[model samples]
Target: MKSLTLDQLKALAQQTSSPSISIFLPTHRAGQDTQQDPIRFKNLLRDAEKQLLGSGMGPREASTLLQPAQALLDDPGFWNHQQDGLAVFMAVDDFHYHQLPFSVEELLIISQAYYVKPVLPLFTNNGHYYILALSQDEVRLFEGTRYAVGQIDLPEKTPVSMEAALRLDDKQKQLQVHTGTSQSGAGHGMFHGQGPGEEENKVLIEQYLNLVDTGLKEIFREQQAPLVLAGVDYLLPIYHKVSEYANIMKEGITGSPEHLRPEELQEQAWPIVESYFQQETKNAVEQYQQFVSTEQATDKVGKIVAAAFNGRVDKLLLSVDAQVWGNFNPETEKVTQNADRQSKQSNLALLDFAAMKTLQNGGAVYTLPQDEMPTDSPVAAVFRY
Candidate 1:
């Protein structure tokens, strides 16, 4: 799975191509559902082909354009390993796809440009967080959204266990066989570590954590999502001390994570991340309400859209599930709301336009539920002025 970034979103927004093919479908990571993934993808590809042909494209041209996506269906390796959702976009000169950790409704939209609204959730404040579960005997990382969690394969440099980290070649050589009798009176034996002292073990664990943090930095470059640590109490602080990520939460799940499943860890970590997002949105909403009477805030979609384009918007609050289909005239600085999509070339996703512009201009965007939007209107903004 490829990591989706804000830069890629900006580039997708700026792309100009006719008859762009966008396909999104839910995929399964395991079970019988895995067998159904390829079938779903093939169905979407067929629909995209029909849409392309209906848009006055030649059958051969449609086939040629969709070839890359079709090939994914036949590749056994691609279908065997899956995420929650797959988004594919194809143009005359550009073809790209990303396997995302969030689930998406199955849909195919062939339009003037790619339909990227589905991918917006990744950038929204309600997106994903990473859970790093560290233990002396085990280390694992999981990418989690509110709905699902998927474990990421660690790099080779990431030590999997204490013995691995200490470079102990033979398990038997490092173990001290205990033949003493148990308190229950039954004869028992155990394997105890014959290597490193307590202080030396701490040093080795710290070095392992440092390596993990280094690898994570590369994965989290330009990422805005918060990171939650889930491990035993002692290990958490050491990781915090070694981690370079600024978004690591001060609060963490305190317990031995060696035995917990990824799903179990996600269940515990989501609340911390959820609380953080709730607080952020609540503060932003309060600020917008307080500034409603001032020049800094407005609920009018036209004004917000214009402000977003001009880089005057400091923050934008809108409903992610709502789309105000319309067109904006850049020359006249006018916005017209359309009752229906008239043409692919003329009609535009106005909310998407505003969101993209706000993001590109270094403004913060909060996506809330429709009823929870800061204003009665679909869009609202706090201005830089």
Candidate 2:
């Protein structure tokens, strides 16, 4: 499955096509739920076919368009490695899919443009995050959202253990190579002892952590997602000193991460990351309220859509369940609101359009439910200027 990135969203936003098929469904990672994945996909495919046919495509042409999605239904292996949600997009010469960490409601929308609203949350600043679980015995990285988590492979240069990191010279060999943990109930690894042994071990551990942090920086350079460091209490502070990632949270899961599964790590780390997002959204809402009567912010759908397209919006608060069916003319900078979302109309979700444009221009986006929206209107925005 493709990892959905900002570039992918930009590409989709720029795409103008007809009879685009967008399908989203909740997927299972394991157990009996896996058995139901194929069946559910078949139903979505049939829905797409019906929509395609309703748009005046012949039966054979509609079948041809859906052929790629149908191939995935019979693939048993793909379902086994899934995350929490699956999104599929099909159009004229374009097909893309993403395995996301949050579950999405089953939705199918065939329209003039691809219905990307279902996956828009993933493109937002607070959608997902990284968990860097560090330990001398094992080092792991996890990519997670509130609903699902998955491990990411570390760089080859990362040290496997403390011994692997420090190569002692012949003079340092005078220090004893003790293996108390290897033969006993303690964790298996080599330990070195010397005068002021704790200080010496801290030095070596710092060096090892630096390597891990360097590797992590390479991976997270382009990401604004928060990184939570999970390890024993003692190890966390030292790693923080060496970590270069600016978004690392002050609070982390305190324990050995070696025994904790990826989902378990996610369970521990999500709250800390989520609190940050919650506070950010709250601050944005307060900012909008403070400037409610000013030109710096607005909740008018037409004005918000125009500002978003012009890169004048600094933040957007969109309702996930609300859709203002409309179309925009870039040449005229005019937006037309439709009375309803009917098939074959030049209609797209204005809420989605504002969110996408805000994100594409490096602005923040917060998607709330209809009840939780910042404004009584369908959308709200904070302008850049």
Residue pairs in steric clash, candidate 2? none
Per-prediction TM-score, please?
0.82, 0.83
For each candidate, how many residue pairs have backbone atoms clashing (under 3 Å)?
0, 0
lDDT of 1 by residue, 146-252 (tens): 88787767765777765676665564346533334445543233435866554555676677788778766656666677899977666788888998888898988
Candidate 1, which segments miss by more than 4 Å at Cα?
A: 153-200, 328-334, 339-342
Off by over 4 Å in 2: 125-127, 152-222, 339-342
* Total backbone clashes of candidate 1, pairs 3 or more residues apart or in separate chains: 0
Query: 1-385, model 2: which lDDT tens digit per residue?
Result: 3456667777787778777778898998889998998898899899888877776789999888899899898788898988788888888878888887678899888876777777876656565788888777678887777777766666667766655666656544444423233233333334565544656766777888888887666567556678898876667888889887888899988766788888789888988999898888888888888887999999998899999999999888887777888888888889888744653354677778788788778888887877987678878889989
Q: What is the Cα-based TM-score of model 2?
A: 0.83
Q: In model 1, where is the ten-residue run with the lowest total lDDT?
A: 182-191
Task: Give me the overall lDDT of model 2.
Answer: 0.78
